[model samples]
Target: METISKIELRNLQIEDYLELRASMIEAYSGIEDAPWKEHEIKKLLSIFPQGQLVVLADEKVVGCALSLIIDDKDIDDNHTYEEITGNYTFSTHNPSGDIMYGIDVFIHPKYRGLRLGRRLYDKRKELAEQLNIKAIMFAGRIPNYSKYAEEISPKQYIEKVRMKELFDPVLAFQLSNDFHVKKIMKNYLEGDTHSLDYAVLMEWNNIYYDKSPKLINSEKSIVRLGLIQWQMRPLKNLDALFEQAEFFIDAVSGYGSDFALFPELFTAPLMADYNHLNEADAIRELAKYTEPIYQKFQEFAISYNINIITGSMPNIIDGNLYNCGFLCKRDGSSEMYTKIHITPNEVAHWGMKGGDVIKTFDTDCGKIGIIICYDVEFPELSRLMADEGMQILFVPFLTDTQNGYTRVKSCAQARAIENECYVAIAGCVGNLPRVNNMDIQYAQAAVLTPSDFAFPNNGIKAEATPNTEMTLLVDVNIDLLKELHEHGSVRILKDRRTDLYEIKKK
Candidate 1:
């Protein structure tokens, strides 16, 4: 550790965040035990305006201390605490909720000899006084400073302490800042030191009182998503369609795509003309043609062991003709959704209006939803599903016009961004010679993200060839969506004028 004198101290400003983050990443380049992330820093900023205390050598930040005010009044008022059995429980009554929690302290590797970590804590204590927070509490990873020294592997340190790491630098720093170890949390992560892995909860009282909370712009959040792009054909010729579908199943399952989707009517052929066929007759024909194909698909899914969206196909339930999508999992559980939006041509040809409701369901990847062909054009349906916490919208369509396809694809992307979810569109691309001379083309596959939108960082993450039968793959992180949704960054669920929309509904 090298010693340096020209250290400047200050609170974090908005402009300083990115720079400070880049520096932290650089400083901890080779230290996995001292991992720091931008999102965590952002969360600190959101909870505390002056929570970040920085030390500058010359003009750059070389250290940081994170602290947050926890009002005893607020704490006392809350009835529950996070507990071991995965439940919240009320244990005791408190006089007030005014408390300050010291989260972490960071010092640049180059300036380790300056004892700057202590200085930052002193500043944090001073701020606690200014905020009038009556009590302070914190936790730390055991074994402290010796744990992070280059000579000591974390594994070795755990053996020395006969304990596991309860916290990191942040928790350990709290120990020297007048907080004591109160509890031990064990085996937090695999391969961590047993004794030191437990967190030592500590508390301090009567630091400060009655300070107003200020606006905080930095909040830790992430957007998670699940994407499934359907790319399979539904034709009467069972052999050829099944073959095409096998390739798709391979592409999706091979990459372990969170979910893989197929087009509407994916494994069944359309009738040349439905003029004489009753609803029952049409569906019977489809079932007769598709039963074997579906059985094979189920087997394929089991072999690959992946979630598959069996795109819409003509089905007969109680003698009613319907277009339905099937949600199939590796464990063999399956559910179906009848298309809620039927086109005029579809109704004229099949004598069906539309299905009744929308659906969102749980899957191994996360909660997902399905909106068939024309159903996607209705923004209300997508918004309803979004409001229900649907993180991925899978669409299966067959269209002829480039304009219509582009419009639907763009709508899917817009819905995804507005909802802070992922939108995946899969359309039929090959020829359907029996229907008409019309050449089918559409957004065969697309993955839209919040970053792709016009609003700063919401938009499309990936999209497939406009008119090709290729399988697209993307890794979906569903946790990120939950963060974005909770924070109201993308404002898909929030910021809506429900009152006004209600009047329009009337």
Candidate 2:
């Protein structure tokens, strides 16, 4: 029986070359090909450190997987092994390549039945995904085919192996690991006598590979935005409020909305329960709901597969009351953005203190930023976010009059054009007379865009009816913004005369 052993997988170090070579000799003895040299392993580590990995049992190297990245166009089934390895020079390794090309993988003969090779393959797949590489490709040998050399052709042997009539160790393992044969080549490795200089081209595509980088820099070209202009009304209970929020989330998710934005302090309706206390005390009490609501948003974000901008809610930190927003992503990950600007009414009535932190949040769809209500009126805030590559800006507000709503709406529109990005606004629009300091509301949820020929002339992608409770759905083309940044008639972002005047956080 194969004995169990504790093992550690890590990047191959140059010092372990002797032990790795010993393992290779035990596994590939009597081969007609050249084995990896100490210099070659050292070069691989120097060029692509993460690709060269080794597995150890009790700190002794037992297996290794060496790989390099290459351009997709460089992949060819009828190529020699040396061609891919840059004639053993590994000059073919491209830093910004699209494919993870496996140069060599082997496990010691004594550790054969331990499934260590599978661990190496799985790690390679993970690295491929992390680097956004398209696929993992390699040329695999048929070591067992030497026994039937005279009786069957290499293709015939492969067919029999696939049909379970024969078992070729390397070919069987590759197949079980979801690798598909791309082509069969002859003389792939002149030293591989067991394979008779024959090899099978195999590939495992990375399903998570964002060909254009779905995260980080390369964002989805088109994203559907949904804004829920919540109505300030009575709440039967907290569960009732969540169920209502879920209804909108499920509705928007059904429409394939990538994000759902709720109004600022949409949770304020719950403040009705604390009406007996002063406005300051009521808001502080509302802060206690932050944890549960934040957690619930995470749950709905995952279940509905939509990123959520949880508007803003009353929150307490270090015994100070503040308004905070949350970014709940579909992948069960989340981030927080505090309201950086405070209103006079908030300070006078609720004693709310503004947050000092400001930054952008990364989502699966794109990079975004949040500046609740009054913060949107500040041009410096959006400019800072734009400088950090924030492609979408969200503003969740609560206003009780047309004058206050206009202040947020007009400034939000200006932010979109000046930042060369998309701006989405949502706010409460109804009366919650029972909720103190939230007796009335006014809003016109809208998705604003930069003013360009590719966008709406008026800069409004879509807007809800004024002073109404509804949802505004809009699809913004991020590619247009990318183009506008370089080719638009008015290049606001690029034309900035930073040499003379600029905005910076102190």
Candidate 3:
């Protein structure tokens, strides 16, 4: 047998109950008039096993610390220990509480000089910090008070302890650990002789606590989006395309959407090459109107005080043709992301070249990325965006058949799940009969989310009917994404085996 003196602190387990209960009895001795039942201890562990911890020395249980979460609003200055703890049952445990209430802590009498209590308190502080709560609050027993109960009041006795005129085994240790006395709690523990049934309220604030209430509740942090499944047709002139753009913007801006997204090549109708030019010639003609179309969308975004993702458009940059997506901010600023993955049709028929950079946009709504049509079909692109802190991805696509649309739709949902992010897709649903190579269209628009408890059942925040020309609006909570990454049922990001494999960009 190994006789080494090794100590370990860890979360309470079901099998540790017998040893833990025995340690509790030895630690409390004559002071524990109301000892905890074994079933009650099991119940506390079942409620929140993370808050209950035990310390072991040489593989033997020697100390334990039990705690429960409580809402700060429910705690008043005059609350007693029993009132806060639900008569020692810990039925008041609130998972969303802002404060961690220490229910009980004890070290076996034989293990008292080993500083085992400090290890238990340290573990509690670590747990509280991991939960991102505001503070750790508990009532401290003044064990030395039995000698002073006849000589001084609870308040006076606490003042003497604070002033260093008297020493309490518990309060003095708590004070040494940076906890401050708040107030006196009377009759905190029933039939307690050491404390005279009085306890002192003590608290230790977590200085690094997150102050944003939005993180705990999704309702407080909403990012509304307007997704437009554009209706396409042959444009009689440039004015016709401008009219359609203005209408969609006016409709969604009234509903107070932070962003309005349009479909890929939404301005393809502007080519109006009634002469029936070939695919390459028609795409080249559309490229000519890119500057004018961008100006118009920029004006619309500023006028309505809404950010606009002007889907994708054909652009001729430095004599090279590329598919580019533009984001026009309400502040009159704009950024562009070119499609890095060019489709076979684009390359073979239009001589389109793929872009070289993969980038994300930082906007008022959130960190966002744009992946055009076929770009989203590749998981690496979305993964890179997510690695860069992108919480939302906008995919603008143009599909000519139901099969093509299904490919994009299914891939979009998978990207949402794999990256734990929101994905909003928009596409053109009608055809420009007069324009060659653009006469057929099949599309749908949808706001997809990660398939997690914090999101919708099907991971679809909102979706337009397939092959329909309509607008869909939905609210996505960015804070919910933050919470999911931290405390979701499965923490994919945190659980990645970086030591075995890694993903990086050259």
Candidate 4:
């Protein structure tokens, strides 16, 4: 005897007919049967290839299961196997049928005693769930019934098997696999003497069936994004920052936005009075308010019932200055992502260093990635987040010129297309006349989507007036991203040449 190395179950293909036919012939060798022609198998495949399946061990076809879809209402009260299936021609396969009718399950003689039948049944159940059908139904053979046909009727024989007082090589196996006997059928098969031409109608209901398009595109499947175009004004103190933050929170939460985002270093206004200090000292002064800002945002998130990505704040942790963004959840819990890419101005002027770790945050809406300003300019950072199952990318940026703003905007749009994910960018606008290194700001808040028919014409779902002090809110459908990855005109995520090159994160 040889051991099975690996088993693979897949949809039936026309090329599998030769091996499947041979297996069917061998499995029904000593029983009365009509051989299935090649055209019949091809017809079945042409109608619904998903309903037919084959199991392979080391590339050898050892088991097969065939099925067809049918409407339950069309099945008559006293339907025979031939009447229900059109004498095995399968011309009755209804594409919109709610019930999946299992036509046959056969295992090669050499593959017997290996529990291959169980594998075939499991595959059928999987197909039912994928199609979101009502139930799996078929007429099961009572193979050992011929021996006891004179002792009892078919219904009585089935009851004994159900009661465990008798054994049915076929019905017992079907029952163990959760198929309940609905009733007995007479003359179910044309030439089945072993079963005395009697079979049991069986069904396995799919209790978890769901097939509504609204359910797929519901609010449960969307992530509402709120982008804040912060006004670059002089901040007298942290109270001024609080006033502006509360205003945006109140405005966006009124519309039920899930995540509210602010611009990078939006809290820099809090250090407006310390502008007389050197550039490095002034940024460090902003860092001192990081703890208080984090605590305030945490409270705001709970009070407004929204998750707040408080943009990027300067943090002087362990004597090293880093740009960090906090994601405060509605429950008052928060996490932070440090900017992994530092700009030339950041390093030369503010003595800022880049972070080492790249991560994504899990929320009620979806998995999100927070990348700040220049970090979005690097493709690998967004790719890493996408690989980690980030369906939405949030960028909090601060740029003083239109050229710098374009860099962030273009890269953000490109990332959305490449990864097939939503990207929301928020930035600061207006002139902070007194704050060094942040005196001038050029900003626009926009929600960018992949370039597809399901999306907007310019790949932007929503945007604020350039350099305006306003909040932009947009609802992004995560399901649309899923559909694009599967059925878009150009599936960038699925068409990646992983064999040629891969994105490996260290």
Candidate 5:
């Protein structure tokens, strides 16, 4: 047997970064949505020029960890954080210590079998120690859209595919390396529609202040879901959308919700032929509108400290356009996602189709998945998010006809029951006409509990008006979603013929 020698990791040079940038784009080729761009690479390298490290094989850089030790002051003052002054900067400067942030950990596709991810991480931890850093944080993706269809319970849908793709292995490797998940960042990717990534915020401790004592007891988990249908006012412009969102958010902000969701297409002016515009052009316009809106929205979130899911819009990417969602925190940082699956009508006439992958975001509420419009139609989509330990799902959609609305409602309920999670859906009210004179009408928006469709549990708790602009505040108990999925008499996920299903795969 030919034995592979242990590889050594070294700090990447400027040339090495250029090489890694090429590799990162290549590695992400399998992704359906937007791929890594030159600018993102440049930005990362500019922040932490020396943070990147490469693993050598036969003296060649086969794998690398793209990390950055961002100075709190530098990052805070950076253009990215201009919306919120002093935001993202460490409030208390540790004059003697620095924060280690892992931007991305990537391995060359050809040399992945030898546990290069782990090797790179080991070196990463060592580097942190050598630097005497107080804490290490990194953003990680939870593969939600990469799931495959399986015959067993829905939870296995994404898990099975993730296992095959080594997504779980990467996560396990990180955990085994002693990286505790501090928080999950939601919808961090651009132009992604499905809930494909759950930004796993990881950390190693040092100089940051600790506010609370370590409790021996399990921390209480809470959930709040806000459902609102996107009501389009034809004459109403972007300002109207923002005003309506503010009004709705202010109205339901009192529910003490941890996370709230607005309907799909909630952010822009709806036109009969808006889809005819360049998706990116439309999104660029939306982003310009969103800049001021998000500025105030972030401040609103900061003031009320609320985490809000401001529904879907057409997002431009690399000159192409996509239907995407934006998750904004009161803290001024925002994550965006796009609709994965385009409807038959959308794909055939409008050049829109399915999204890239599944992604879940973390918030004060809990681990949640944001799926927009037609993307949620696929069971595999929701199942993938559920398998990744997501407690809640926020669906923003625009459906016409009571049949489609009911089908969506049923799908939401089924997703909750099969995955044993809570599902919230916000849809559009009134009639929305595409430029082609095609109009879709929605019956209502609803919030569903895990028990909504399962036995010993009844139907939907609350629903909005069928043809009116309305907001419904739904109280969600995250613990219940988490607890029921645990082994119980009504154990839905635990008892299954997981092994037998593989036979069918062959």
Candidate 6:
């Protein structure tokens, strides 16, 4: 059965979030903190049901405008994004509030340039008039501000936009609707690279309203992790290898993925540059390129707007060589994780040592943990990560045979179920000729969730073809993990008997 395409406007239902999410992913590609999570939407609807609305096309969610009635006393004249909506928990929403505050609005990219946004705005205005609000206020994002950020100040750029000399998609439309800038606020929406995290506190005074107040930007953070099941091949120089990695990062960014996972020792293919030396010296020589490659991946993370897990690399610290990797976050911050359970071959061939820490790292969405290759086989590290509140565990591995790959895969799934968290494992496939101790690999990259009604019955959300060189993009809801921890059929986390035995940190 085929449905006819027709545009319709109505109040947003809780069920509309999934469709709205896909539309939102397309609308804000290469932008972080773009899509709103279901729980946040539920909070808004429960707090102020009439303020949330949606636009549907042929029964598909294509556009939406979310809002809440708030009091100005709870918000300040110089408010940051966090202070406005009570850190996106929407705690500031008050039923007897004196102002009409807009939290979010966007149209599907495919349906853009058709004034759909204008229609949504008109509906919001009607609702404001109907309720008799004081005015409509929004901390509207300046999306185009980043283009000329180096050449012009934010205030000057806003002036140019207001003067009609320069056009800003959000601000221009807002200006047409009689909204004027209260002021330009800094770091209004954190990690909004396009806006340099700057936004205008805009307001359109209501003439027909008798009473009702204040809102800034509100974006819900969820993670879509994209894993690169890499193919081991020869590259002549560092530039070629970096170019290849950036290609995958670009592809992942286009999908609006929050993080990109690369396989363990994916950089091992570069060891060919020093293949003339003995195995230990050669791998150590490969370590020389680690810093440069990490620096380049950091640029990719920021420029492409995706966090990058630089699969395992060789790190020589204080004369001790370690199997290590780095997490290059999109917000220009980074973290490092080393393999805590180095394989026997690594110790024999490259003198690799296990790293000490098993800590959780924070991302824009939530806390995450990283383990390399053999680390997953040891349950203690993962338990330590889980104890530290890690929601997603990233495992970057290199396996030489089907048996090796199975060990990592099975253990990863077990970790997900037992820890009550998501686990994403990636590895290199094919062969890297002429590079000692890195000659062959077999991989089946996948993201595994806990076995629960909300998750897959078998616990695998997405996986790539065995031994294939491809990208596996999967969207895992952080809320699902939260739900599993709180109300799943088997509460693995809650059921752990610490009194019997426990794994304590040294």
Candidate maximizing lDDT? 2
Q: Candidate 3 clashing pairs?
A: none
The alpha-carbon deviation from the true structure for residue 346 of candidate 4, after best TM-score superposition, in angstroms, is 0.7
Query: Would you estimate the TM-scores of all the predictions?
Result: 0.50, 0.60, 0.57, 0.58, 0.52, 0.61
The TM-score measured for candidate 1 stands at 0.50
The C-alpha local distance difference test score for the whole of candidate 4 amounts to 0.85
Worst 10 residues of 6 by lDDT: 212-221
Cα lDDT tens digits for candidate 5, 1-506: 11232244677765655666566666666656323355554555555555667776555566677665555454331122112212333232233436676655777676665555765675666566556665676655555434532233324533443355434545555665677666545445543333353345556664323333232223435455667666765645656656777777766765655566777765545443356665434344554454465455654553344677877665556666567667886434678777877887665544554557567777655677888766666777776776677877888877768788877888888887777777788877765454332355665777777663232356475778777877787776666665577644476667656767411110
Write model 4 residue lDDT over 294-378, tens digit each, in one string: 8888767755667899999999878899999899886446898899889888999999988988888998787989999998888
lDDT of each: 0.60, 0.88, 0.84, 0.85, 0.60, 0.85
Q: How accurate is candidate 2 locally (lDDT)?
A: 0.88
Model 4: pairs clashing at backbone N, Cα or C within 3 Å: none
Off by over 4 Å in 2: 1-219
Error of 1 at 92 (Å): 43
- 288-365 per-residue lDDT for model 2 (tens digits): 888999988877775566789999998898989889989987655788989888999999999989999989988767
Candidate 1 residue 90 Cα shift, in angstroms, is 41
Cα RMSD of all models vs. native, in order, equals: 19.1, 11.6, 21.0, 18.0, 20.6, 16.0
Question: Which regions of candidate 4 are displaced past 4 Å?
Answer: 1-219
Model 5 clashing-pair count? 26
Please give, for residues 65-153, the per-residue lDDT of candidate 6 as tens digits: 98988886766777887777888998888877767889889888777754567667877876776676777898998899889989999
Candidate 3: segments with Cα more than 4 A from true spot:
1-220
Q: Give the TM-score of candidate 5.
A: 0.52
Tens digit of per-residue lDDT, candidate 1, span 1-506? 44332345688765666667766776656445444455555555565667678877656777776665554444322121233111211222122346666555567677664446766765666665665556666554454634455577554543444343444544544554566554544443223342234444566655334456543222212222223333323344657676767776766654535466777765434444431466445545765555465566555554455567777777667777778767766444567788887888777656564678676888655677888978888887877777676877888776768887877877877777666777777776765544432225455577777762232353666667666657777655565676676664445577778877731221
The superposed Cα distance between candidate 4 and the true structure at residue 394, in angstroms, equals 0.3
After superposing all C-alphas onto the true structure, candidate 1 shows an RMSD in angstroms of 19.1
Q: Candidate 6 has what TM-score?
A: 0.61
Per-residue lDDT of candidate 3, residues 178-285 (tens digit): 899888887777777788888888999987688774233313268889999998887778888899888998889868788999988888787666347777877888
